[model samples]
Target: MYAVFKRELFSLLNSLMAYITIGVFLLALGLLLWFFPDTSILDYGYAELTGFFSLAPFLFMFLIPAITMRSFAEERREGTYILLATRPLTDWQIILAKYLACLVLVLFSLIPTLIYYYSISELGLPKGNIDTGAVIGSYIGLLLLGSAFTAVGVFASSVTKNQVIAFAISVFICFIVYTGFDAMSQIFALQYLESLLIGLSVNEHYQSISRGVLDTRDLVYFISFVALFLGLTRFVIGGRKW
Candidate 1:
């Protein structure tokens, strides 16, 4: 598992994908937080990063898929799946290693954004009147949300040998899981069903956490969501060998 993790990390860093993913994230961050003029948070209001956090999950819908699309898909495409299957590692080990590698990459891209937080702190009216709790909460939510998306991407990649198809499927799945429940909430006839749908939506939990409210249920929801997809990924890969 450790070897597989290292290899995936090394391969990702050596390729253009790593640079492109980081570059695009930084570009989007810049555009939304700094260069967008009227809508720029820094230009308009307090040191609140509401805009940044608001845009992040949506941006991650694309960026996470880009990073994870080739994890298993490319291996199968290059006929390396047989080699990996023959190794001593179980499917769970392989999936977990790849998932960890992808999570590390996502966190790597996210760490640099702390500079924005620092800059906002320094520029604030009272020298850091910013809501530190909310900022921390938002970052935590972002990490969990990214992890869930990465799991979905890994599962999608495991189901197909074509990277493009993997990317497309991952993006589609991410879109549905992230926002589909919210949409369903609008159409549900029963009030309890509507509430349940809203509760199942990723955006709802994200919003709650981003507001500095760390609900245990929301945290569990994210963890379970990630585990569900990762388990499915392992089952899919194992089934293929059978």
Candidate 2:
């Protein structure tokens, strides 16, 4: 499992595409938050990273899928999945290795953005007036959200051999899981069902956590969400081998 993990991570880092992907992710977010006069942080007149936290999840819907679309998809497309299946690793181990590799890359893309937090903190009128607690919570929520998206992306990639198809499926699934339930709750008439649907939505849990309250329920939801998709990836791979 460790070897597979290292191999996957190393393969990604060794590729020019990996760097390009990270660059694109950062550039897109940076331009939207810093350059566009209309929506720029300076124009917002608030010394907070609310814009970043708000925009990141939406952008990640595209960025993360693009990164993981090639994970198992490329392997399966090139017939390398057969070679992988013949290895000593279990399907779960293989799935985990690829999932973690993608998660690591997601974190790498996020680490550079911490500078934004620093910039905001210093830019505050009273200096360091930003809500550190909420910032910390938002970062934690973002990481959890990114991990869940990565798992979903891995599962999507595992189900198809075409990277483009994998990317499209991942984006659709991630977007639905993140906000579809909330939309459905608004449409449903039953109070109980509406509450249930909202509770199931990723955006709800993410927003709750982003408010600086580290609730165990939100943590459990994210952990379970990640596990569910990873388990699905294992199931897909196992079924393919059979």
Whole-model Cα lDDT per candidate?
Answer: 0.90, 0.92
lDDT of 2 at 233: 88
TM-score of 2: 0.96
Ten-residue segment with the worst summed lDDT in candidate 1?
183-192
Give the RMSD in angstroms, all C-alphas superposed, for model 2.
Answer: 1.3
User: lDDT score of model 2?
Assistant: 0.92
lDDT of 1 by residue, 35-141 (tens): 88866986777888888998899889999999999999999999997998899999899999999999999999999999889989999988987899999999999
Q: Which pairs clash in model 1? A: none
Candidate 2, after superposition: displacement of residue 13 in Å?
1.1
Candidate 1 lDDT at 106 equals 94
Model 1 bad stretches (over 4 Å): 188-192
TM-score of each: 0.96, 0.96
lDDT of 2 by residue, 1-242 (tens): 99989999999889788799889889999999999987799999998988999999999999899889999999988998898889888888888899999899999999999999999988998999899999999999999999999999999999999999999999999999998998888774655589789899999999999999999999999999999999898888888899
